[model samples]
Target: MPDRVRPMRTVPRLGTYNGFGRTLLGRTKPDADGACFATHWFTLLLLPIRPLGRYYVKEGATVERSTGPGASTSTTEYVFLGEAELRASEVIRTYLFRWVVVPLVVAGPVTVFGLNSDAYSREHPLLFLLLLLGIPIGGIIVLAVALGLREKFLSSARVPEWVGSGPPRG
Candidate 1:
């Protein structure tokens, strides 16, 4: 009779599978707008130096390793700095990235296109107002989005808050 051999198995570190670094850059995850943070900043600061389209770079796995019950794998994701410093300027960059860029995307082009259209048209006057209003409105929207994104993604974890706003009685 011939002898049979069993395949080797491995166990991944606890919580490692749930980590952002691993899943974010893994093959199973699709390449999406994970570049939102980097894209946001470029659209603001650097885009003015060059052009809007040249801001964000491609997103993909930079490092990969397998470690599973049999063959699990992980990857390290990276964002192109695009002339922007990630550590030294994270706070300001994060602010600009989240707020200004995202909203301007919709408002800026619309206002520009609307205002440049035939001035003789009746809608031209309305578009002029729209062009003016769009600036501040876009700014506010960007601020809100930036604040929200920061709270959601940038905020660090801490101990849970106490219930009822104070100490609990035994």
Candidate 2:
């Protein structure tokens, strides 16, 4: 009698490496809206995190030694959510903090910097310096805040639960 061997089968693996990858590659199941909202915003803010995690996580199966001869252990792994979720949450929180809180923190300094130039025109060259720096600093702060707000709104509007659900449960 001749020995026979079974053919091996392999499955293709896919993952995103950047923010866009998560938005594009993350599969939206009928009930996976929460995951999608998480994914979409994450993609906008931290595009690199999700896809990188996907790419780095093991997506294949391989054989290893088992207890007995002619026996092997093969393990197959799917994408990991630990790093992915953490990164996504951080991205969201960062945007939220940048947009919602940073302006208030910087506003007082900016206002005082601007006012210094009015009363001490002759006596304080440093006031002019502060005013000069303050304007640009305020502009940068505004830009950062704007970008954060835009990204947050865009991501937030894409809540998966609203758009992705299949149908009402009866």
Instruction: Tell me the alpha-carbon RMSD of every candidate.
Output: 20.7, 17.7
Worst 10 residues of 2 by lDDT: 1-10
Please name the candidate that would achieve the greatest TM-score relative to the true structure.
1
Candidate 2's residue-wise lDDT over 83-154, tens digit each? Answer: 222244445565555455555556656666667557665678777777767766776778677766665554
lDDT of 1: 0.38
Query: What TM-score quantifies how close candidate 1 is to the native fold?
Result: 0.27
Give the distance in Å from residue 107's predicted Cα in candidate 1 to where it truly belongs: 7.0
- Stretches off by above 4 angstroms in model 2 are 1-92, 105-107, 130-170
